[model samples]
Target: MIDWNSIAKKFKEADAILIGASNGLSITEGLHLFADNAAFERLFGDFKRKYGLGCILQGMMAGWPSEEEKWAFWTRLIHHYCGQYQPTPVMNDLKAIVGEKDYFVVTSNGEGHFELCGFDPTKIYEIEGNWFTMQCARPCHDTLYSSLEVAEKLSAAEQGGHVPTELVPRCPKCGGPMDIHMGAGQRMIPDTAAQARFQNFLKTYHGKKLVVLELGIGWHNQLIKAPMMRLVASEPNATYVTINLGEIYIADNIKEKSFGLDGRLDELLPALREACEA
Candidate 1:
């Protein structure tokens, strides 16, 4: 359990809140990346039967048979997760805790839940890109565009787990195949403008009472986790708090100032909100 009073006190005393989130909180909010259930089977039975695919990552891999198959799968993936997006209690709880606080978020989540949950778009840095946008897959261009029109068409028109060939997205600039602007691999592109905004936030409030509230940080990409630890370690007035169900560690210097709450986010988030409110 976490010290609710201290948590509340730190939050109140902090000059600004910096949130860094990974996939654990996302799964608890229903954007499951490694889905293994009847729902996945119902939607991707053909993919499973033909390719023995067990997870969404497998389908998004480089060896997915053909562009047709790849586009079909991507359409469904974006449709279910992004096009039909819904915010969960965890997002609402976070919003409650951040209520009227000067805050900024740098998240790797591509699902755009922060915006859906009513966080200020300008204050949030979607570092990993978003599912609702597309970019040239051939590395031909750096521009990103809204995929809402295509996502809607795909959701409405895709049948038997395949999107219409005419609806398949192609880069308008080079006629190359387009990919969702998600940071899953080396080709992943980051939003430079948003990165600049985040840099400004850091520059403007460097030595203040900053609290790094990290949630569900994973081990794969060091984009969020590594930088978060470094930032907290550098600032003596900073406090680091993490809500992760698994291993959570801190350096010798930051140990006393850090807090850890090990538990499932879906169960812990609402309770955290209650504690903060009380």
Candidate 2:
């Protein structure tokens, strides 16, 4: 594990710090992204019996062959993760730290925690897109519409261990498919505004004395993490600080300038916040 005391000191001295959050942190705070719960198990019991699928989350992602089915699964996921879930103290602490500094966020977490915690949308780069909105599955245009009402309906219908077919979402215009902009594949459309903000952030801050604070970013999706880490490494005075449970390692190029803390963000962020404050 990296010495957080030293890491905190480095963070305090940095000009800009880009904090990143991932699904692991969300999971640590009692939100299951890909895991199954009792409710989901019951709802998917029939599907499970038919396909030998144990977890609803995994089964839905794996079993769905079409965009329409994928959207249905994501619609359900977004409804629960955004509306019903509570933000962790760690997330709150991290938000506080960023608020105190010249900071930006580049996160893969679809829960929209940073924004919910009052981070400026311009300063926050949501690479995985938000859970509160849906886009055309085909993504003919980079348009996103609010999914809050739909999410609420889906959540309500998901009671009594059943997912009502009527609650299943479809494209409003085309009557086709609508999915969360989660970057599942090439078809995944990033919100154009968010994409512009991310590019602006990169262009403005690249190769600077920045601190890249990554929390619970795993290897499952290297699309965002790898490039961001590389950007930090390219800078002469940039440092990469990663706090993750079990796995905590960085490239050798940034190793001397990096701190790898092998632990949960729920435990680490508050400590780091105190240390930074001190």
Candidate 3:
């Protein structure tokens, strides 16, 4: 019962767009972190058999006996999910919706899809970091090392669920283990430059006709969702459009200016693109 035409009109009239996304958006892009479905089984069946880990997230958090084994798992994950990722239809639809509008993307997803989809890298902030980079486990410094080459090499060298001991990535400074630059407690190096860029984006669009387009953000996500809602509440001209799988929510204060489209993103995004063109 959502009005796609009305939502498209809002998108068209907006002076700037602010996008907020989370794990649900990643799911729409065929990267389900929590599900142990056919895709997960196909990609990670060996890990499940070896470690009894249920899903991608479990494999990410599971303790391994050695750094070799750990890197073996990480390399496979990075190789498949990051190195081999191609932009999906959902991403293309989103691009059509945004069109030529000035936009900034703030996402908790670490999968690096926004960059892969041809979005402006400087305008996208990955709050949980991304799969394409790694940092020292002890975080000896703030430097983030590119893991693309490392992942490829390790993935090729991996044998019997373990990479060669010499092939494991070690910090150049501390010689400690390296971990993917993600949400790994205090050890994770923060993306201060990206954070600054996002803050600047907010400042630039403060009182403009901003469209806060939230996609697949769950209720528990205070990191991205809460701040977006707050922006909508403060900016009188801001229009809030949220699309999710179920139980779409609009803040009571901004309900009058909000549109909630609840459905699968794969279906909704293409329909929305059609509506926008119409």
Choose the strongest candidate by TM-score.
Answer: 3
> Which candidate number would show the highest lDDT if scored against the true structure?
3
For model 3, the superposed segments whose C-alpha errors exceed 4 Å read none
Question: Across residues 14-88, which tens digit of lDDT does each residue of candidate 3 receive?
Answer: 899999999888998888999999988888788889889899988787777888978888888888988888889
Per-residue alpha-carbon lDDT of model 2 for 75-157, expressed as tens digits? 55666666665766877888766657678777777677667767787787777676767777786666787776777776655
C-alpha lDDT (0 to 100) for residue 46 of candidate 3? 89
lDDT of each: 0.80, 0.70, 0.88
Between candidates 2 and 3, the one scoring higher on TM-score is 3
Q: Which 10-residue window of candidate 1 scores lowest in summed lDDT?
A: 60-69
Q: Which whole-number lDDT from 0 to 100 does residue 256 have in model 3?
A: 96
Those runs of model 1 whose alpha carbons end farther than 4 Å from true positions after fitting are 219-221
Q: Look at candidate 2 and tell me the lDDT of residue 204.
A: 74
Winner of 2 and 3 under lDDT = 3
Count of clashes, each model: 0, 0, 0
Q: Supply candidate 2's per-residue lDDT for 180.
A: 62
Q: At residue 3, what lDDT does model 1 achieve? A: 81
Pairs in steric clash, model 2: none
For candidate 1, lDDT tens digit of each residue in 78-158? Answer: 777766778787888899988787889989887888887788888889877887777888768788888767877777777
